[model samples]
Target chain A: MEQYEKIYLYKRIVKAKLFIDDHYAENIDLGNICDQANFSRFHFIRLFKSIYGSTPNNYLIKTRMEKAKILLAKGHSVLETSIMVGFDSPTSFAGMFKRIAGQTPSSFQKKQHAQKNAMQLNPLLFVPNCFAENNGWTK
Target chain B: MITKITHTCIYVLDQNSAYDFYVNKLGFKVHTDAPMGEGARWLTVTPPEQPELEITLFLVAEGGMFDEETVQIMTTLIKKGTFGAAVFTCKDLLATYEELKSKGVVFKKPPTKEFYGYEALFLDDSGNWFSLAQINS
Candidate 1:
């Protein structure tokens, strides 16, 4: 019985993760998440928490923020990146970024540039790999 | 027409750790490490000469498409080291199983003959369930 519960829990976790990875940039709600994992809302929440230390809401935010950071680094504007990550309003997006990342989008981009500069300062950071040798994207 | 698979993406917290498991432990070859955006790394790999299909290594953070609850589940599973799974085609399933065993790869089940070929289950470093299949030639 306990083993079955364990397996059930495992499957739900996998499903939930899949839902997040696939739809992290969309408008997601608790009911939708539960439905995607094929679990009751109450059971899904409990099992999710038991397996993952954080709540579902926190995970979504983190995933979006991480994506935003990447997009920002890639030269996308704050508004563009915000919309790309499914934020309804730029203000809300900025607020969330400030809270979670401790900076606004512009500041984060600045930091990224600084970090890139520092990496360039270290010659060993740019060691050319044979696999990426011909790929235009890496260069 | 049965076209080749281009890529499959796996989200992870640590890129280097995942790379170690896929490349060093599982014997996959690193095919490319393209810069994705900002701090994100787009590391890809293939099996031997099978460079046509590559796996994308993605790093997960907070927000975006997933609500707080969904991220919690994925993060939890990833932390517990039981995230996802893959199927790798091998030249010799039985021999490969033995070799993986020598490398301390644990198996939940032994290889058995299926209509398609020989199949066996092994957990990746993060507890992703993957099967090794080698067709009888």
Candidate 2:
């Protein structure tokens, strides 16, 4: 391929990716994403997979799952997190979360909560032993 | 008070490839190349015009600030072109684009007139894209 043509192809793929990034929460479809890149649906799917090593739909799911992990870690409820991340239903969300995160949403949140609680209980973990000793700690 | 930004990072897949891309292709001057322990090196470069700011070509690996899971996620994200880290400005957009293209740099967008100015998008060796723009004066 010519240099300019290659650049053009790369740019179209970049555009499709940017569209996915910006509008993942919306109900995006293959046709819409292909339109952003100005490529036919069939051609876009093959081109995207060739470049990114994943289908566009899989990329979107990954994006949503990443966002859902952040939200769940921040203490969002499963239903709310599901809706916020564009999952159609909480059941599907929990299943997909387990598949990707190796646990359910609630389980992940519990782990994060336990870590937070442990950190809170051991406030001295934030302070250096030398500083504690200088400040008049015996042991 | 925070005065000026000194250093920023662009995560790359490999340091040697990044070195060739940034130094040999982009024509950036190497600011520091020192051992940083644990098989890592502190590699930084500065643009030709912007010597004050150093861009660290940080390698994405399973180590400091990145656990194994985080490294996996970052690797996937980087390969998918999820990061658009920074914008670089050149004196002449078309000339710079041509120059970089000749050096085997892969640009995603050629110099085109945008609403803001003349801009182009290019990918580094690691798939992180950057906007090369010359703002309207």
Candidate 3:
């Protein structure tokens, strides 16, 4: 492809991505996303996958999974996190989460909680000793 | 006290093309070019008139905040011209447009009278578009 053509295609793909990022919590479909990019559904899917290596539907699921992970880590209930991530059912959410994350939401949350507690117990572990010394800490 | 934005990202399809477009066509200065681990480079450039702010030429790839799936989505969006990266100001929009065009920069729209001022639209090497405007003083 020519450089200009490549640039133009990349820009269209970016539009679809921005739409997904902004509306992942809502019920977003491939047609609406393609509309945002001003590309037909067939061409959009083909080009999107060729450029980024994933289909639009897969991309949406991945984005939702990422957001769900954040909410789960923050101590949200499984049902709430699933709903917030736009999943219609907790069972489906759990299934997807396990497939992508390799653990159930509850297990992920427990691991996050343990990690949080560890960080809190040894805050210095996260902060450099030089930072404390520069701020006037003796030890 | 609040200061200025030190860094901003402009996602591009290719870093080499972006480098040529921004540095050669736009006449911007390279601020930083360093390795960012994981086969990514931290590339940033600054406009000639605005040295404090750095325009990071971030490549849209499958790393950092993106996974295999998310990277595909972002790459497609960028290629479609979905990202209007930023608005640039120039002392003379007409002269700047001409100069940039002479250096092989492609402008979607030439400098024309907009409601706010005279402006033009141009695409960077990575599919991110920007508005080159001379706001009315």
Best by TM-score: 2
lDDT of 2 by residue, B20-112 (tens): 999877868776564544576667799966888889887888755568998899999998999998999875576567657766788989899
Query: Candidate 1: misplaced stretches above 4 Å?
Result: A118-122, A125-139, B1-137
Q: Cα lDDT for residue A48, model 2?
A: 84
What fraction of the native interface does candidate 2 get right in terms of contacts? 0.00
Q: Against the native chain B, what TM-score does each candidate's chain B reach?
A: 0.79, 0.95, 0.92
Tens digit of per-residue lDDT, candidate 1, span A95-117: 99999989999999988777666
TM-score head-to-head 1 vs 2, winner = 2
**What is the C-alpha lDDT profile of model 3 across B11-126, one tens digit per residue?**
88899888888876786877666543456665779997687788878777774456789789989899888889899988656556655675677898988888888999998877
Ten contiguous residues with the weakest lDDT in model 2 chain A: A129-138
Native contacts present in candidate 1, fraction: 0.00
Instruction: State the weakest 10-residue window (summed lDDT) of model 3 chain B.
Output: B33-42
Taking the tens digit of each residue's C-alpha lDDT, what string does model 3 give over A72-132? Answer: 8779999999999998999999999999989999999999888667654544443334533
lDDT of all predictions:
0.71, 0.79, 0.78
Error of 2 at B43 (Å): 0.6
Local lDDT at A109 for model 3: 96
Interface RMSD, in order shown: 14.4, 15.8, 16.1
Report the Cα lDDT for residue B89, model 1.
Answer: 79
TM-score of chain A of 1: 0.80
Order the candidates by lDDT, highest first — what do you get?
Answer: 2, 3, 1
**The 10-residue segment with the lowest total lDDT in model 2 chain B:** B32-41
